[model samples]
Target: MKIYRRGVKLDLSIAVVVMFLLLLHMTGMMYKRELHQLFNEEVNISKRGFRRFRSSEIVDKEDETSKVPSEVAEGPAGTKTDHIPAYNMFHQRITKDAMYEPSAFYIFNLLDELATGEISNVSLFPGGSQIKFKIHFKNGNVAIAKPKRHDRGRYWAYDQSEPFWLDNERHNAEIASFHLDRILNFRRVPPCVGRIVNFRKEILPNTKDEEILSTLYINNGNFCFIGNCVPWFCNDNNPICSEGDFMEMSLCVLVYPSVEHPFQDRPFPWSQGIVESEIWKERNICTEMLVDPEITMGRFFLDLMDLAVFDHLIQNYDRHHFTIVVRFNVESFVVIVDNGKGFGNPWKDDTSFLAPIYQCCRIRNSTYQTLLDLSTDGSKLGNLLRLSLSQDPLAPVITEIFFATLERRLGQVLREIDKCIENYGNGEVLVDKVVVI
Candidate 1:
């Protein structure tokens, strides 16, 4: 009886040990599964790029014990997915009296903050008549700030004196151009704003004198004096000094957002010198190239046409090259940058610059409709431009005469469109929709 009892006890002990081992294995598997699920929730593969799963989606699938909240996942709804429709992301129909978009307003606010924020770094661009400084803000945002040189009469290679009306107010021109581009529903131009900032004294030691004059172009009227001729200048110092030796001279600057992955240096078929040669133009090689199954040239042509129309409206003829953004080096889209050369003269109309649109005879449907509407009633468009530009820190940068000139340019554009319709018919002259992606 004693031996049987000992055997039963040993068997029971073995059974308990086996159960404990099984439980440990199960717990480990559960822990690993939870980790895998969390990782999946944190990263999602989208057509545009890797986007994080929305907090709601993550929380819905996650265990109750998870720490992340649904509210923490909030971001721009348009950016939630990787595959964004080109038209939906880039195009917005604008009316004559259209107000600024909330997104645009938000950007303007951010730009204001960054401009006022503490400067972390400043570096001068290598070459240019109007010196451009790469400024880094404490908020981790980067901007290219071009100081006001119009009053001082600085000219770049592309800028000619005859376009004297441009006034070299490149900074103001930039902001005005951005507003006009927005009005035209072309989301190519980067958000630009006029900012008055004082340069830090620390930057002076690093920047060259020539670079300072070329880029900053501080004048007697704009500079601050220290003790009867000892100039004490810094980015944030007041232009007028009462007692303090330090004085800050305000620089009228145009701040443009910095893009991370620009195909600025990359060469495309259209960028080849031979392609731009007169021989190629005479032969019309560019137009003759049929659309490839892999890459559609129609989208490129459409974007080019849009850009040309925009340049004509502003009288900017210095678009020698354009920047592009690409995904996986396969799909690419144009990014409009360096538009300070626009708005040359309010009195002059450059019909030659509209050649692309006239020759192509294809405009976006929404753009065409907006132009037609504006042609009928331009007061609203003028009002919208005034309102849009008046919000800039430097008010009245764009005058009423400028708005009138814009209307005249718009009328010319309409005439060109009508001519195209007469020649090619509406079906061919107007592209219903053309998206790059």
Candidate 2:
């Protein structure tokens, strides 16, 4: 009787072990199925041909590196990750000195005040082909000013599809970009404002650059001056003239504290090339960027994807180069500058501007969510932009045609995201789970 009882107990124990193993297998299958439903399909490891670690999985041991906020590290007790890696990356870098970081409102107000103030000093801002002036205010503030080059209602007649069209930077675009950046909740652009200043009184009198002074002249009773000639087009033949005494221009605020934050200008991977073989449109350059040793170590890939989205919305195709802030031994923060090239042609929708999106097939979840929130009836992107730009000194910065194009382009972006989600699962497309450690 004892032997029979032992045999029964052994059989019961074996059955329980089998059931437990089966439950684990079933759970994994269910989890995978759910993930697929959330996305488009289960991402095949073999298809990608490489193993990519999630941002959460890429651990950083150094204390100097930007710390992930507590809210991001540990969300509501049982919830999944709720923090966006891309947004957090930018936020952390900018707000490292939260005690001193100026609010958007403060910056905007200060910029306006400075614009109205006297020009204590003025000099030629070197490097760019176009003529830019570095103006100093009596309050020790400085700004870079770009004179109004083109009228608002005009559109470039060149073929945007070629990607190498001759385009002039517009002052209105510079001001509008700042407003648009704020509306998109990505305050990457520096504070900018438009003001009509007297060329003879405020600017030419304070001018320090010999080249700038040499170009100044008078035409038809109005103050006129040809800027330094560029290799391509700008010359005495086409000079920017003021209406009598006043010249309209956009002033971009320059705010660099005493602390020296190192900035490096890196060439865009998909930069336009004159040579046919160097064209990036025909290739999946994102795959190359992903495998790069430096890019893989930090959140560079995610930043590029975010930039692609931002540039696409504004129809900026001249992202030939970008500046990255190297701090804490990582290349994380991307400083957005040179926005004058955008908003040139509203009718042309350049799909090539979205190479990072379609080629990489990845996007930050926070960016996607914010885009959806702004796309609604009451909070449409166009209305928000229109309202924001109206507050500027130079109201009606952009035309109604440009506003309509922005809304249309936004729809196209959302559709592209939907297509990506349909093709790949949510697990594959939405890569915002990455946390900067």
Candidate 3:
């Protein structure tokens, strides 16, 4: 990958992995660039990189969790086993409009208020576990909901809000995702309002609800979060919605409209009443920038790569679907969202970046086409990113705040990797065992 960066020939890795990735990305790029290429998207993807902006530097595990008291780790958070539901079983037709329709049913099952946390506005839009819900509290606070774990290891809710992945790495990844989010915020990155969970122990399709929603979790750790998970691909009406034939567990976050809908919630007096009243939107994982409107130029081919890399620095695995809603008066404001996957590896370092999943400066078609569709004034893609690292308002959505956040984060990642390479220690089997085990 680095070789490709230096203008060298593509390596074996790029030939294999990048080629496959490009095949899929290009296919969409071609199509998106066609037909609706005139459409102007508003937001943009972070970035994709070799190791992304994560704290996933492999370290001496022996010195890791061991630092924390054994009892604290072994206590309730020690982790128990959790089961995930089958693919495409939760929401067969993941569409944005449909999420609101089935939400009523899921709300009933997910409003119990567990020991650690409680979600509100429970709405069950169909997905991976046949049940999805928006969790809210009477106090007006909310978190997305699914039947997460109970104190005694029981699944408190009745829907599939838990998560699709339940692996140990993923378990830790949850907190790492948040940690990464905070890390990014340290540099002023608004978290990508998204969610991330495990896929382990998921029941196959046709399984009984008792067996499906019945899946449990032993390690709740950071598996739980309070944000959207629909922006990526999960909430987008997929194969059932599109013409493709894809059936799998998808992670996502919703991207709601920026403007308010007074028809739903009337004008408010004091407080962020209106902003808070507006329902936020999100979606699932695309791993790369698809066709986002905020970005319409530069390596128009793969804008997602830039966003992915930006996310890497934040260590935000869940950026796939989250939000950063802001209020500027009765009707003026901006809200950034999406964080399905952030903070790559919780147990790693700020130096380590993944090769295949690394955030890079490649181009994808969706952004390219979307840019082609935008007027020069409305467009803000790669050129904007370059400006972001230096200026502001290359366009509205692409602000200098975002550029600094992204640039500093990238610098942090490079510095870490530089240290790792400089230190050059030989500890692979040890690191792998600690992470994968």
Candidate 4:
């Protein structure tokens, strides 16, 4: 109004004001946009995180490379998983020809005879550190050929007293494992011939070092009367049968085939029935029965061998040795032949895993020590175990297999039982003991 004629100062002031306003407006808009973006991104991010934590099927897949299935409840490393929930993980084997050896046909045939009650004294011979013996039916007609060191005159009876621990679970597991082993061995990915058959738990009475033995269910004890590979099948019809040619597998006759199974067994729906399948074994040999029965020899040195497997008579809660006998077509195989459980823990006992996993891991214990000192390398068992880790017989290559498998499956099992703390199980679950003589 004053006709200022637009002085330079005034013009400059106006320009400055305009610039200020423009700057303020731009800043405000940028602030609003930034706020909107931040809120939106936060909401989206939160939603993803929620689902990632909430759903395992979904979130777990995203982290597939990072997750491990829990074996024990709250593993030793403070892992959040409740391993117990995933208890007893078995890669179930539901087939007959798990082993497809030409030997299997004959092996199965001989086994069928026992299942149908054709023979008696089905004995499992010892291989390495295994010792499991069982008696099928009382062949009063048959004699106890391989009596233990103490048996003066104990004839074939279900109630014989011996030094081994026998039970339903051991027998059942052996049968089930045998099925697996025979099949794998058939393919020769691993040596099936050297597998420990039925499992026999041995209790040393006053000693802390109890023995867990597996057997081979020998057709005949490790001696030979014939050349080539042929086990003399035990036949009662021939009263003059010798433990010879040199030995035939102990035979068991299931005189009256049970309308139901003779042992504690669960058959998968598609299969006939499951005897023990040796899912994991020490060797990866073929699953052929001995073309030369003599090839199915017992462990060479008893004093050196550790655990016993495939023994016929486990007489704890129920009898699985009978099941083993039926498979080999034999009865009354050799066993420690005692009814007392070492720690009074039966096959079905809750703490059974601990016994094998923690209790039996000791290197100084007789069973463990025997295995150590007797090896060709004395300490080379580690080499064998390392070789076993590749595939097929996933683990459980030694007496420690049950121990290892249990310690693994029972990552939760150890939760309830604190026996390890009580005794410092110094048990090496995955690693082997270094036996320094």
Candidate 5:
């Protein structure tokens, strides 16, 4: 009996040890899978071939050679070699304190006060459809203000009698674009807000009546303070013309903070040759044209990819040029400005505008993951945008259709990424680092 009991106890002990080892092995496998997902390798697809490297490996290799060559050696005649300066490609990441981060409410208040405050100086800008003014406020703030009355389809660009193109107005679009930029974590767009001001009181005295009449006109017997309308006789009985004090104009103005130094303008080197080409003119160029040489390829692609994603999200196809700001003469970053031409018509799905991402077949891992999360939970992103815009004192400029369009575009972007992953491994398709600087 004692021998049988010993045999049973021995078997039970052996079984327990085997189960413990099995659990440990499964845990280790799960951890390895997570690490693989987190640190996926990036593949650089170029005319030469596809080069794959881990993010850490790339950084280590670049660190070994502090300076990238400014120019490449001579190749066959007319053979183009990307000679972008390494400094231009790589920029140092900005710290929290060093960044010009501000709360939405704070910016809103500042813009509101500047729009309505007593103006010390008012001058016309050089170009654009509407009558834009550079205003200097009593508080020493400066801003560019574009009244809503003079917007497209409401007022003629050259003649007040002729209406501008439909849906050409940009003030509301400008405000909405800024709001979207903030939501996307792209802090490139400057702060803008909408405010209603009496044009006769705020602007008429400062400028010529002829200039004002040419830009601002009466429509439907009412003074169209900022946008276009059918020409109508302005009689004494006309409510807007009769009570001039009641003619309040809605204006979308962007305020500029005083920076120690102005941003340096540098044209994109790769685009210089193709700007006037038939392919560019027709907007049919592929992603291959954007590829830079290996020296600066890593950083250059990062900036280009981010910009491509951002433009697609807003449906802004007018990004021919961008500004690069050199901070402290060492670190630099690209500033995405002039985003007023966005969110034109919600009914149209312009997914072609995102050819860069779809064609390139790669994206930053963080951005890709965030996009997936947002895609799965539709209301989460919409609610976030609503909450942010609702905080603004101005009426909501983003419509329901527009929000739907945004979601549709986002899903399309994710589909493109998924396709890329299918073609190439996830490690090769999804990049880990977007900005080294």
Candidate 6:
């Protein structure tokens, strides 16, 4: 009894201090929630940076209330909380595809409306060899549309080593690539959806280009047109025709109306150039390219690794160039803008597509982990892709064989990463963060 009072007093004081700290933390969190609600009312997230909601997981015409707000709000410390939605929300879906942010879901709905949205203006979008149209929505939004050229069952007839330019830029591939981007939780590809438009009503009247107008003709009661000639097979009088005036196409949103956040295009290191040189494939260009002071210091190399994995999954070897968002002081984000060449061949898994991963022997830790998570026997990536694409108005986007091909390619990617890990330890192969100057 003489000294026991000392220990009891000490225990009491510690308990009181712990309780005070817990109360303070609770108050701080409550205040933050109140402030966030006041500023942004559209989104809701939990304390762990993930939100769980039980809305219609698949998009359809009936769900109008779930549309995502396009405007962004400034968060604490001036960061954009909704500019490009992070994977902060969870869907109640069966697969791990539930990881997409809420805004991503909203974008899908917006893209679906492209099929039926009232058209304001349409004109030829000149740049690449493929024919594309810049479509202006009556509501003031603009999109770049790639008309359907290949059938859903079109198989890859060319050899694996054939030049990528020979492949047709498929509209379904563009839409599928966007969904795959969301599935991989990359959020790099812009929002795209498959749209069926009438050439006579939606495109022909709106298009004033004499070159395009001259190419228009009716064949088998379907509206058809051969786009302006480019270096490839486009000028051979092969027209992209609609199935009786209705053509299925992919519409990609045109982000950044003004050039406030302009994009800077950089040529892919492994490209075969205009002449289709074998020099890039014959030797390991990454050996010399990796040593550059600028490449070694920035996040471009890391982005290339991601691109390699992405391209390999979809069997798209035409990554001749990539675009990065350029702005003051901030790190550049790679945008997988042109993906119409993907899904060209579900039968072939091009090893050259894995060059960036194999040669560099590096990959982002987040990407590696996500791929592993999706490749599990129970949670097959292809099955999840099928689930996600099922939401489109033009359902059955790709053949069932393509789903199996996706899983097969994912296994190949895993093997590549495993090889890199075996050659170099995890410390050397797995990058923790995207280091930017």
Point to the candidate with the largest TM-score: 6
Q: In terms of lDDT, which candidate is stronger, 3 or 6? A: 6
Q: What would the TM-scores of all predictions be?
A: 0.60, 0.73, 0.25, 0.20, 0.59, 0.74
Q: Rank by lDDT, descending? A: 6, 2, 1, 5, 3, 4
- Candidate 1 vs candidate 3, TM-score winner: 1
> What TM-score number comes out for model 6?
0.74
Residue 370 C-alpha lDDT in model 6: 84
In the range 343-432, model 1's lDDT, one tens digit per residue, is 656766758567666655677777788777555542245555664565454556665677778878888988998998999888877875
Please state the error at residue 217 of candidate 1 in Å: 10
Quote the positional error of residue 166 for candidate 3 in Å.
8.4
By the lDDT metric, which is better: model 1 or model 6?
6
Tell me how candidate 1 scores on lDDT: 0.47
Stretches off by above 4 angstroms in model 4 are 1-106, 117-348, 359-434
Worst 10-residue lDDT window for candidate 6 reads 1-10
Please give the distance, in angstroms, between residue 210's alpha carbon in candidate 4 and its true position after superposition: 38
Clashing pairs in 1: 48-82, 131-215, 150-168, 198-235, 198-236, 199-234, 199-235, 237-248, 238-248
Query: Ten-residue segment with the worst summed lDDT in candidate 5?
Result: 1-10
Q: List the global CA lDDT of all models.
A: 0.47, 0.61, 0.25, 0.23, 0.46, 0.64
Comparing 1 with 2 on TM-score, the higher-scoring candidate is 2
- At residue 90, give the lDDT of candidate 5: 16
Residue-level lDDT tens digits of model 2 in 232-283? 5368677878887777888886544223554567777765544532657667
Clashes of each: 9, 4, 137, 101, 11, 0
On TM-score, the stronger of 3 and 6 is 6
User: Candidate 4: lDDT over CA atoms?
Assistant: 0.23
Candidate order by TM-score, decreasing, is: 6, 2, 1, 5, 3, 4
In terms of lDDT, the best-performing candidate is: 6
